[model samples]
Target: MSKKILISIPIFILAILSPVAPIFYFGLNTKKIDANIQRLLKYSWFDELYSTDKFRHLFFANKHVRKKLSSDIYVKLLSHHKKTQEKFYRFLEKENNRSN
Candidate 1:
C-alpha cells in the first residue's frame, strides 16, 4: 500500500471512531445507573439520598450525572422540555363554563 493511502485510511478511521467512544461510554454508564436506581428505588435511604439538600447538589448525590456537558445545563434542558410538554398538553384541555 502507498504511504499516503495507508496514512489517510488510519486518519479517516480514527476520525470516525473518535466520537463513538465517548458516546458509547456515556450511554452504557447511563443504562447501568438507571438499572441501579430502579433496583434501589424501593429502599428508604435511596429516596432520602435523593432528597437531601446538602447532597443533592453534589455530583454523586441524587443520581448519576449522565450528560457530556454540565449537569446544570442538562437539568435546565429537562426542565424546559417538561414545561413545553405541559404547555402542549394544556392547549388540548377544555374549560367548563356554567353559562354560554
Candidate 2:
C-alpha cells in the first residue's frame, strides 16, 4: 500500500507539471534565440539579403511567420541595432576626444 501510494504521488506530480514544462523551456531559450537573431541581423549582408523581395516572401509570407516577425521580434531587432549603433558612435566619440 505504501509503495503504491509513493509511486502514485510522483506520477501525479509529473502529470500535473508536464504541461507547464514547455513554458519554462521556451522561456529560458527565448533570450538565446533573440541574441542569435540579433547577431545575424547585425551583419551588413543580412540587411542586403533581407531587403530582397524573394527572401522576404519566402520567410515572411506565412501568416504566423509574418505576425511573429513583424510584431515584437522586428521591433526588438530594430531597437537592438539602434542601441549597438549608439554604443559604437559613443566609443568613436570618446576616441576622438582623447586624440584631440
Candidate 3:
C-alpha cells in the first residue's frame, strides 16, 4: 500500500465516525450508569438514600439522565410523579456510588 493511502485510511475512518462520536460516548456512559441504577432499583436501600438533598443535586447534574427522567413518556403515563422521582433519585445515587 502507498504511504499516503495507508495514512489516510485511519483518518477517513475517524472522519466518518467523528460526527457520531459524542452520541456514542455519552450513550455508553449512560448505559453504565443505567445498569447500576437498574440493580439498585431492585433493592429497598434506594428508598432511604434518595430522600437526601445532596443526592438530588448531583443526580440531576447528569443531563442525559435529567432528560430521560423529565421526558420519559412511558414513565409519565404509568407512574405517579412522586413515585417516579423517588425511583430516579435512587438510581442516580446508585450510579454515583458505583463510580466511587
Candidate 4:
C-alpha cells in the first residue's frame, strides 16, 4: 500500500503538470509584455492618464503594480504643473511689487 501510494502521487503530479506546461512556457516568454508596456508609456494617448479607462483599468486589475506606476507618473506631472504655477505667480507678484 505504501509503494502504491508513492507511485500514485508521482502519476497524479505528472498528469497535473503536463496540462499546465503550456501556461508556464507562455509566461516565461515575457518580451511581448515588456514591449507592450514600453509602448504604452512612450505613446500615451491622453494628455492626462488619470482620466483614461486604460489607466483606471490597470489600477483596478492590479492595485499594487498600478499604484507604483500611477504614483510615478502623477508625481512628475504634478511637480511640473506646480513649478509652472509657482513661476507664473512669482512673475505676477514681482510686477505687482514693482508698481508699488
Best by TM-score: 3
lDDT of 1 by residue, 3-100 (tens): 99999998999899898867666553555454544544455544554465543443242222323113344334433565743442232221111111
Global lDDT of each candidate = 0.45, 0.52, 0.58, 0.47
lDDT of 1: 0.45
Cα lDDT tens digits for candidate 2, 1-100 = 6999989998999899999876566433445544544655766655654565544443333333333344455545544676754553354345444545
lDDT of 3 at 41: 49
Prediction RMSDs, each to the true structure? 13.8, 13.3, 9.2, 17.6
- The numbered model that scores best in lDDT is 3
Q: Which stretches of candidate 1 lie over 4 Å from their true place?
A: 1-6, 9-20, 24-26, 29-32, 57-100
- TM-score comparison, 1 vs 2, better candidate: 1
| Candidate 2 regions with alpha-carbon error over 4 angstroms | 39-100
Q: Compared with the true structure, what per-residue lDDT tens digits does model 3 show for residues 1-100?
A: 9999999999999999999887777553455455555544454545355456656555446664544543446344324456766666566767677656
Q: How many backbone overlaps does candidate 3 show?
A: 0
Residue range with the least summed lDDT across 10 consecutive positions in model 2: 58-67
Query: Which scores greater on lDDT, model 1 or model 4?
Result: 4
TM-score of 2: 0.33
TM-score order of candidates, best first?
3, 1, 2, 4
Q: Could you tell me how far off, in angstroms, the CA of residue 19 lies in candidate 4 after the best superposition?
A: 6.4
